[model samples]
Target: MTPIIREARAGDRSALIRLMGALNDFETEIEENRADASAAAEHFAWVEGQIEAQGGVMLVAEAQGRVAGFICYTFEEDPGAFVRPEYRRHAMIWDISVDEASRGQGIGQLLLNAAETHAKASGIGEIRLYVLEGNARAQRIYREAGYRNYERLMSKRL
Candidate 1:
């Protein structure tokens, strides 16, 4: 199916929440249950706030008139935020998720491509995202999209 991708509207907030929840569930299942529902809710709220404040763009992929996936990204021209100047030369893909039922279809790729196109139009030279260490599927997608790993983000739970 040909998916129509467009900038997200206010009406898409609820659909975005649902898609995020579904994506979290999928990740939980794949990781043998490391996902926390409360944490997901909190993160979603933070995402909403950031969207409101940072002027980032949210792109939604629609199939059959329903939101099948979404991608949120930010363009940076300054080095103030968590994004550094070097990274700012490229768009940052903060979040990208497709519903489980819609997996394996080119929806994710389409979303990423849309984000890249937006970035290029905005004068960004590159794009970047972080995939969990074991997320081979996502890594594969990034690689296929012409992204190469340049850094590792290590974290420890305190």
Candidate 2:
């Protein structure tokens, strides 16, 4: 399928929310062994607001007249917010999601390539992302795209 990748517009809010909910369900299934559909829906309102705010950039993959995947990120001066400066050479992948039906079609790779191209043109150094410990599939994709595991972070609520 020929996937059209383009910057998301305000009109894509609904589709974006749907894709995010799908990803949330996918993650919940991986970790909690349950689908928290209700919780995902509840968070969509706030997520939509954030996507429409400053510094936010969302890209959507459209195939067959529908949105198949999405990547959302924000450019920031403070690399410390999520990654160390040394690792924040250029950009960060805050979130990337491929709808379950669209997995394995190289859509994720296409998105990453587009992001990398954008970063390179902007003269950024590196692209960084955090993959959950158990998400080997995503890790593999990032690794195949030239990202390395430079650090591991651990946290706990006291």
Candidate 3:
């Protein structure tokens, strides 16, 4: 089914929270990154605040009258504290998730397309996002959607 992509509203909070939980579970399973239920709750709280604050755009893909996926994003600018100003303006995809059952569907792409469209219309120069190191499926989808890795983040446990 062709999912309806729309701006998320207050009425969509519960569905969004459910999707967030699913995303957290998937990520935790893949990486065991301490993404427990409490972490999901905390993330949901942040999302709820973002929704209420309108600091960003939260969009949801609805199929069969239910939310199948969601994407939250915001426009950001940095003064380039020590670098050139060319690295300043960009759109950041804070989070993107599609339910496990909805995988293989086009919901994720639809959300991404909508976000890119919005970024282009806003005159943003670039769109940025982070994918967990082992998320090859998401990386492939992003690459196919015109995204390329520009940097890598690494850490070491002390």
Query: Relative to the true structure, how large is the alpha-carbon lDDT of every model?
Result: 0.80, 0.74, 0.83
Tens digit per residue, CA lDDT, model 2, 1-158 = 67999988767767777877777777785676545555655565654456456345578899998888888665445545586765554456677888888999999998888877766676666767778877888888898899998779975656
Model 3, span 42-105: residue lDDT tens = 7977865764564567889999998899998877776647646876777888789898889898
Local lDDT at 70 for model 2: 84
- lDDT rank order: 3, 1, 2
* Residue pairs with backbone overlap in model 1: none
Cα displacement (angstroms), candidate 1, residue 10, comes to 1.5
TM-score of every candidate relative to the true structure = 0.83, 0.79, 0.89
Where does model 1 exceed 4 Å of error?
Answer: 29-35, 77-88, 156-158
TM-score of 1: 0.83
Tell me the lDDT of model 2 at 113. Answer: 86
lDDT winner between 2 and 3, please give it: 3
Candidate 3 Cα RMSD after full superposition onto the native fold (Å): 2.0
- Residue 26, model 1: lDDT of 61
